[model samples]
Target: MELETIRETYQSGRVVLINKPLQWTSFDVVNKIRWHLTRALQIKKIKVGHAGTLDPLADGLLIVCIGRATKMIEAIQDAPKEYLAAIDLGATTPSYDLETEIEQEYPVEHITEDLVIETLKGFKGEQMQMPPAFSAKKVNGKPAYEYARKNIDVTLKSKKVFFHEIDLQYFEPKHLKVRINCSKGTYIRSFAHDLGQKLNSGAYLQGLTRTAIGQFTLKDAWTLDQYIDKINRLNKYKVGEL
Candidate 1:
């Protein structure tokens, strides 16, 4: 927990649980940590990476691996993930989220609480899912979003993904919220888009927060400020010593 201890162990490896802030990419969090740690530990460079990539529109629990711990990224990414997602019904977007403008709208008048609950149940278990075009999923050696940004039509392949659980937490006429527990590579954005189709309506992701990954929970993660302040304090103490 002390600065000296962290510096000594950093090369060996350290796993940091960060509560990633909204509008910040997972890589942003990694870069910030690496920058501070490099300066604090007086190291020339340090390896840092995140286990999974969270969208800029979403926030919460991001696992950052430092030094030797970077090797664990693959294993950590394979862990099951949990999310709290807010979905906007009766609307659809090209990105299946707020990143893109709504391109269509459908009727939510026929949708009811009972129907929503039943529809959510159908999503459980193994099913094929298509990742959103605005996602980091690679296509032809470039992120799918590259082509999507260029307005280039690109066919995407659907992959088998399993939904461990999908619980409707709240529902309204035009919006609903759910807590989802799913396997690796599951995209909540795509799930939102697909749910609308199944209900004979349209929907898009309004907001999202990753709550957990394997055993790591958002509750146990540190905010960027918290970690930065700690590092700064240690740096001040080191200066005092000198």
Candidate 2:
């Protein structure tokens, strides 16, 4: 089903920014787009790829490249990203997200909104951070998650990450809403996780939304349904008109 559609988009090179749905892997969406384009446009084959890999649990802008544009994927992936999230207090997860079970828990008291706001200032600049074990990062030529599945101990070195801004949003004194605009390697999950530790309260990401990636905003992106509709329209109408 996928190969049939890639052939069509191969005829005309174009790029697509898709608003990836939750639980859909980045590769899943990229392959689907490639295949959908080929079948809809009657191309023989299309090389499709995405700018970055968004965790299946996180939903947001995914820059997809078709044909020659695929070569420029890295440029997009290195761009800045923005995310809005809710941090759950009193618990920490191995994955730094709710997808993983609890690794540790802390007492919920002393978690005042003022303390949360003041603590955020410390994360606003550059810092060294270790990626969560249950992540896609490579270790000893293997993905970190692969090693995690085997229950093998893998020590990950901390990387320097730049945080553009970490602002406090609606603070409930328990769960907190915040906006994080940061560099490519900065992980909001780790930020929240570490923030909790610094405050003597464990933390995990309760919610996340990639509001933007570099210049691509959620508004200029397409849903799967909308992409399908556009492709069908192109089939019935002139490509120039589309």
Candidate 3:
């Protein structure tokens, strides 16, 4: 499609599926796209927002809404999400993920593959999950992570979340790979922590990737560089041609 056509569509509103890069916040992708769009379309400002917040340490599909499409954010966020997570057993972290150093360790010698599989079955269906301290959840009008980073104690209430499926994809001593299909607001990091507790060992999230959100899949998403390059190519199209 021509630059002019793309610009018009964006102005009218559109949904973009982005494959978020590792260590990049969901907001980072939105900001980058917004920056490029304003410059490429020669506009002072344009509305851009993401449907769900993906942790900076995790990577994968993110749904970004542009212009009038921004109104779709809430609905999209309500959709079910799928994730592939790697849990490192025999250890616990303050942040429940690699964002923090290992705070403690436990023996995983007794944790067999069968035990792991049985434990996973217990996680399926509905349950209340405590949001991690290092999360975007609000606490006294501030983000919970702010207090966590400062080592301040704060109470986070458990919220209801549903897990439709929890499948153990790979298993080895001290490590596990699993696929999860869950409702909105489910936190995989917390799941990792909880799983460890149930198994008489400790665990932390080692890696995570959001593979799908509702009907959207990572396979159809564009990389940030790919989208940016497409926008940069717009400079070659003259206003007179449109």
Candidate 4:
């Protein structure tokens, strides 16, 4: 579609899939898109929101809704999500991911490929999961990470989440790669943390990529540069129209 046509649709509403860059928070994507659209369309304001929140350390598909489409954010977020995650065995961090420094290490000498495969099976289906302390989950109307940073302890309850599939893609002594398809609210960081405990070795999320959210795939999403270029094109076209 032409940039102008896209801009026109966006004024009312449109669902855009963006390939989120690593280290950029989900809000970053929304803000960027909104800023660009407002400039391209010469509009005073634009309603924009994201369907799901991707961690700053992860990258891949992010569903963005503009204008009236923002109302569908809840439905979009409820859909299943898929992720390619790299789990680091034998070491753990306070956040269960590289967002925090490793606080402890364990022996991986006893871990084997067969054992890892067997252990993965245990995570499939419905289970209760405790979200990481350094997460966006709210506690007493404040983000959990806020309290965690203050060195305050808060008891977080477990939530039910379902894992439809857990495909082990690779395995080594201390590195494991897996593709996970799970329900909403399923936290991959927590999964890695729990897996380490089950294996008698510490583990944390070394890497993560959100490959899909429902029918939206990273392959169809626009890169930040591409999105900006299109917006520029639209703005130029708007000048021609005037």
Q: State the C-alpha lDDT per candidate.
A: 0.91, 0.81, 0.92, 0.90
lDDT of 2 by residue, 1-242 (tens): 24334334454557787899999999999877767776775666668888877888888888888778777888888988888888989988888897788888789888888888888888878899989888878998999999888889898989999889888878775689899888897777888899989889899998888888888887888897788687666645543444
Off by over 4 Å in 4: 1-7, 235-242
- What does the lDDT read for residue 94 in candidate 3? 96
lDDT for model 2, on a 0 to 1 scale? 0.81
Residue-level lDDT of model 3, residues 107-221, one tens digit each, is 9999999999999999989998999999989999999999999999999999999999999999999889999999999999999999999999999999999999999999999
Write out the backbone clash pairs for model 1: none
Arrange candidates by lDDT, descending: 3, 1, 4, 2
Give the residue spans of candidate 2 off by over 4 A. Answer: 1-12, 238-242
TM-score per prediction, in order, is: 0.94, 0.91, 0.94, 0.94
lDDT of 2 at 184: 92
**Better candidate by TM-score, 2 or 4:** 4
lDDT of candidate model 3 versus the reference: 0.92
Better model by TM-score: candidate 2 vs candidate 3: 3
Tens-digit lDDT track of model 4 for 148-240: 888888888899999999999999999999999999999999999999999999999999999999988988988988877876776355433
Tens-digit per-residue lDDT, 1-242, candidate 1:
45566576667887889999999998889999889888988888999999989989999999999889999999999999999999999999999999999999899999999999999999999989999999888889999999999999888999999999999999998999999999999999999999999999999999999999999899999899998776666645542231
Candidate 3 residue-wise lDDT at 1? 50
